[model samples]
Target chain A: MSQAIDLDLLPEPTTNVAEYSVSEISGALKRTVEETFGHVRVRGEISGYRGPHSSGHAYFALKDDKARIDAVVWRTSFAKLAFRPEEGLEVVATGRLTTFPGSSKYQIVIEDLKPAGAGALMALLNERRVRLEAEGLFAAERKKPLPFLPQVIGIVTSPTGAVIRDICHRIADRFPLRLLVWPVRVQGDTCPAEVAAAIKGFNALEPGGAIPRPDLIIVARGGGSLEDLWGFNDEAVVRAAAGSLIPLISAVGHETDWTLIDHAADRRAPTPTGAAEMAVPVRAELHAALASLHARHGQSVTRRIDAERRHVTSLARALPSVDMLLALPRRRVDEAETGLGRALRLSLSENRRRFGEAASPLSPNALDGLVRDKRADLRHAEGVLGHALSRGLAAKRQRFDRASLSLQPRAMSARSDAHRQRLVDLGRRLPRAQRFGLERLRTGLDAQWRVALSLNPDNVLSRGYAILRRPGAGPDGQPITSASELPMGAEFVVQLADGLRGAVSTGTENAGAARTKRARRAAAHEATTPAKQGLLFE
Target chain B: MSDLNEPVLPPDDSDVKRMSFEEALAELERIVSQLERGDVPLDRSIRIYERGEKLKSHCDRLLTAAEDKVEKIKLNRAGKPTGTEPLDSA
Candidate 1:
């Protein structure tokens, strides 16, 4: 209790302790923070980054798991950032910390921003891809197909790097071509700018200028880590690649690594060498293909000519020779002459047989029986002919159908079919013509048979006419049938109604006279039928 | 198909020389197909085939005569491209 009373009685005269204003406190704290952390790297995920402010400053917070610190990048510093800071991206913020007097909050004004790790860098890359893709930068329709053969190839890569050399060597090995190498810093802060400018520069060149404009562009780089190859992901580089007038092939890294430029490029080669391979075809293979094509063209023409020649030769073969045409008609005339002699003998025999039948029977019943027999034979013949014609037609139709279905040449088959049709038509007409000829000959032979019966010697002898026989009158004569057969003064025997009588015939050369009475009947018969004899030698 | 007697004008040797590799090869292919199809008359076939021969030789020359080495872009002191220079010594 006494100590408390003593303390209460103590003087309140502490005057040396300095008091400061809020502004002064804030300024001192800012100064102290700057001095302590003037140059520091804070590795943390970026928070609340929404791009640059209208005033051209970036304000964001860098946060680790447990703590967060405000970060700001000035306009100039933002332009130089190794990569654009993205929200929730783990980055190493390098800057000094200064207090904002107005907010009474201390923040780090970031000088340079870099992705802290590969994982965070990939995340940032993916986010940027989503944004750029949404703008249709990587649309497939925007891509241009590379020319089959490019006369001039423009390459965007560092001249000093092995990537350019590898590309050149590969291109030379496959097919040599004009190459325009736009030497650029492949990686670093200035890399993206230089590469983009190189692409745009090539695009601006006039076509067929002193330097021929490139038909193709290759933006290539050797394989490297994400950070080393980060320049290819720059917006300028990707946009330039997407906007190239000529087709562009991006070979930024190994097969597994893909940069934003790869997406934007017309083609994405796995390596610089691969890009060169894609640019041109092998010269040797092309030469071989062209040579084969030329040879094939020659062979095809020869084949066509051969085919036409064969066609002409076959057509010539189809025409009948002149000898064949003449021989056919000449043979038919020979056949007709030989057939005429046989027809005369047959007609004589037929007339005798008919005469015998007529003398034996004139009954109506016999005539009816003969007619029935003839009709039955005709029916049988007609049935057989009908069957034969139908069968032949069926077979011919079948043959024609098969020929049509076969793969034989159409024109040749069609011509042969016409010939076959003509033969068939001629064959059909021949039998009908033969039947008409037979009917006419039968009517003529019946008339000749009646006249021959009238000239029979036995019938004439019974009519009080003696048949005269004379030596040397006929080659083998039993009787002299006409006065023209007797010589000038030959003795002849004449058979009268009683018996044989001796006679003498006298005929002068100037007179066509018959000395015997037998000559009268023979002469009258000749006068009545010069028509029957005419059939023999007409 | 056109008439067999109709004349087909063929590209001259000079035209083949001016044609690019793709153009020459395409024309050569077309000629081969025309002959192969037997659509062209003998006179026309021979003429176009001669043209194809010229095209083939021209493409071969294009392949053989390509610029062999790469050329580097030459920049001025201000870092602006002035022209180009051979990158390799040859």
Candidate 2:
């Protein structure tokens, strides 16, 4: 099995080869890749796409049936990518080829990429539809019931597009309500992310914040190419649609263009205008419906009342008449009254019979006999009492005569003589006592008179002190001890040991003070005037 | 946060706006049913009928009196909606 090949065919191994580090070789290869295939467009089916990495840089492999090439989309490039790379999607990726030194692998750094063709895009969408369907995102049960009439409707679409204007016009023509538009790029590299964000943002709105949360959401776009509408097929957009708390209506393209969001949303409208129509009922129609409802309500109520009234009337007719119902009771009452009168008359007659039977035994003759018997007994008692009384009276008279005989007049005369002598002795002693008392009282009066005389005003006058007074003021004038009390030219009195002497007030006897003194005396004599009023108010 | 699973949050009453169309409709229906039953007394029937009339009027008013408010969400640089602006921005 071992066949020896020619020695010359095997080149000799060189001992002194160019010395180069692994980095240098790798760098050379990297440079060669960058320069030679700086820009290339390759068609392949995307494989191993699990979305972008955490760094936002997408790492995947593009492979045809024959071969596969590693692809790298940097975060910036991925952001600018017109369409997201889907797993199993056929795309024509355009980018520069470079080597990853770390992994020792060559890769294309994609800048711009798109689906290879409309057919390929459709295939990708179908594939996605199947995968998402398997994941239950497209399940009918996941759909939310659209609000009957949303107070606030949220729209996820481009702000400047005709699609938005159409939606607004349609909504205005119909029931005009609060519509909160979450502006997004309907078609571009950022379409999916922006649309998804818009959906999530509307969901994130606080229910009662300054901005009200939307009760319904419509992700709408106008008619465009399949490529233009591809963003709606994005997994992010579909997932967001499926996860919306508010019921969502997808209106991404024309009726012919269907996107994955259509399957995921609660409802699908043919166009943006259709979405608006779906969101709210026509105002005129709603008014008409409400009016009809109101009429129906009124009719039902009136009918119920009429029916109830009829029922009441029938029930009243079935009831017995008041007079008929009371007839038996009234008759019974009258019977009872008549029976009561008869019973009273019968009882009266019965009472009379019993009284007559009892009275027969107690006739007047029998009563007289009883009275005669009682009188005879009383007469016998009286005779006996009189006889005993007379005997007792005779005995009492004899005893009295004996008692009188026993009494002595001499003893009584003797007692009266003693009493007279006692009266005479008492009378004599009382006069003697009265005379002694009179003498004692006279001596006490003499001592009191001596003390009173010693304290008399005459005694003070004899000691060289004379009393000064206002002349003619009183029998005993008010005293004036100081000369200041004298008014100029006014007469005053001075009392000596003998009597009060009148004098006239002349000059030099407190000349200035005298005028004020007289005025003060007069003022004091006058009745006091009412008190001077203090400040009554500020 | 799909409405199919999560409970619908109650409407905010702090806002002075009248009842929403759905609420008014539902209430009107309920009152109609109540009034249709003859078990209700006359006084109570009249009162509830009046209430039903009010609810019906509220629904009707909601349909006609509402002004169109089409405000597009204004987004920040990060593509996050910060608030809203009128749709027809000249």
Candidate 3:
């Protein structure tokens, strides 16, 4: 009976039991678990990373390139994080192991996590870039040129927000361009369609004949995360910008951020104000450029003018007048005058020779002498006539003297008787001798008259000087008779004389019978006496 | 010919001959792209920087003119624009 008491005292080979309460037991188990795996490192991709909220708790996942794990942290621990925890983040967590008894669940109470050094995010980005480049989406040739000075610019942004105002203010401040504001939601469900419509609206204004069809377009918004800037990344907005007729300049967010709109746009600016600055060139710079160009053009034009002037001067020098005038052969004025003088002298000599030849036959003195000789001959003829008349008178006187002597002897005997008879006869015819002598003188005068008449032109005509008679007055006014008188209708008669042809007209005497009578009478009278045919004598 | 060895081609600068603002900006972008691509040699990269310097100066001048305009607007806030204002003098 003592031996049985000794075995009981030896604790009967008892089970290992803990000497603590239920709460203490659980606490101790947790402490052991934590101590065994104190500050462990986990390698997994983050699936859900709820960032630190107002509750100061963060729940997130650590994900691989494909799979992920859940993660959580309290406020105190999360506050110490250098980087924000997020879903799809591959990270390594440093935490103590903990367990819950209610569901018997196990987890890590995360104290810290860091990027796993290499992330799938960077790989994904690179892959996308490569893909876009392969498709020539990012080709430099695809890029367009922007306007140097755009007057009207269209902007796509939220209607009532600081983004639109910020853009407008900056653009207005820089350059006072015509701004056509196209308001659209930058975020939320309607953002994609609204952004696309705004870009399309700007294009529609062009086709619809709107004033100042937006020279440049700027799609812009403030900085945000990938989700916030997703509107710009929409395929519609990107396509709209790419297809737009006008140049587009995108200014989506901060410099680090990029979007699809930026890639497809004609140009990209980091900020809204930066985009506005590119739209216009400065007035001052433009003025300088214009001045330089003007100077250059002026110089060129001046050079051309100078060249033309020189060419004209040379042409003037080459004219024909200069060469032709200087090249003529020489001649002397005095020599030419001498030659003319010699020609005049020869002409005078030739004229003198011709005059001597023509006048040699008749000397001036001989011509005067011949005229004097003819006058002397005429005087001789007149003197001979005078002598002959005187001789006749002398012969008659001698006859009278002889007859008187004879008569005187006879009268002496019968003187007494005849004296008485002669006295009586003397009384009857006083100076009968004087009377008879006067009678003889008269007879002598009559005979001389007959001789003179025979010597006259009329008597000469009777002696036979042929006379040409026309029927009428001719150019010489000669007489003409017969039907042939006035052959061409002229009128006159012709009288013949010794040395003269005298013309008489019977044309105006009378009519036809009277004219014939006058003509017959004239012919009869002309034929009456062959020796003397004068009417005065008749 | 010896004097022309440097090949001093005339600078293109005038209202008609000068490059447009957009052209200058596009060249600037090419320079940036060349630098980012890293495919260029170091010497080429330095050349690109030199080219970029000129473009930057041009951009700065443009910006300066804009700043002056801003200042002018602030000064002219009190009066209506009159026909007598000389635009050339401005």
Candidate 1 lDDT tens digits, B1-90 = 457655445455566777778988898888788888887766767787678778778877877778776798887766667877888742
When 1 and 3 are scored with lDDT, the better candidate is 1
**Considering summed lDDT, which 10 consecutive residues are worst modelled in model 1 chain A?**
A529-538
- Name the regions of candidate 1 deviating beyond 4 angstroms: A1-39, A44-89, A95-112, A303-538, B1-18, B76-80, B88-90
Report the C-alpha lDDT of model 3 over A269-292, residue by residue, as the tens digit: 888778777776545565565444
Ten residues in a row with the worst lDDT in model 3 chain A?
Answer: A500-509
Candidate 2 overall lDDT versus native: 0.83
Model 2 chain A weakest 10-residue run by lDDT: A529-538
Better of 2 and 3 by DockQ: 2
DockQ-derived CAPRI band for the predicted complex in model 2: acceptable
- Compute DockQ for each candidate against the true complex: 0.45, 0.42, 0.04
- The global Cα lDDT (0 to 1) of model 1 is 0.84
Model 2 TM-score on chain A? 0.51
TM-score of chain B of each: 0.76, 0.58, 0.52
Ranking by TM-score: 2, 1, 3
- How many backbone collisions does model 3 have? 28
Q: How many pairs in model 2 have backbone atoms within 3 A of each other, for residues 3 or more apart or on separate chains, i.e. clashes?
A: 2
List residue ranges in candidate 2 displaced over 4 A.
A1-41, A45-81, A86-88, A93-112, A304-538, B1-20, B23-48
> TM-score per candidate, in order?
0.54, 0.54, 0.35
What would the per-residue lDDT of candidate 1 be over residues A1-538, giving only the tens digit for each residue?
Answer: 3443777788987898879999998888888888999999889998898978999898889888799988889988877765767678788888888888878888888998788878888877889999999999999999998998888999998888689889888888888888998888887667888999999989988886766689999999999888889999988999999999999999999999999999999999998999999999987788788778878977887888899899999999999999987998999999999899889999999999989987887878999999999999998999889998998998899888887766668867899999999999999999999999999999999999888877666556665666677655442347777767767777888766565667775767445443444578878887887653323211
In angstroms, how far off is A295's CA in candidate 3? 3.7
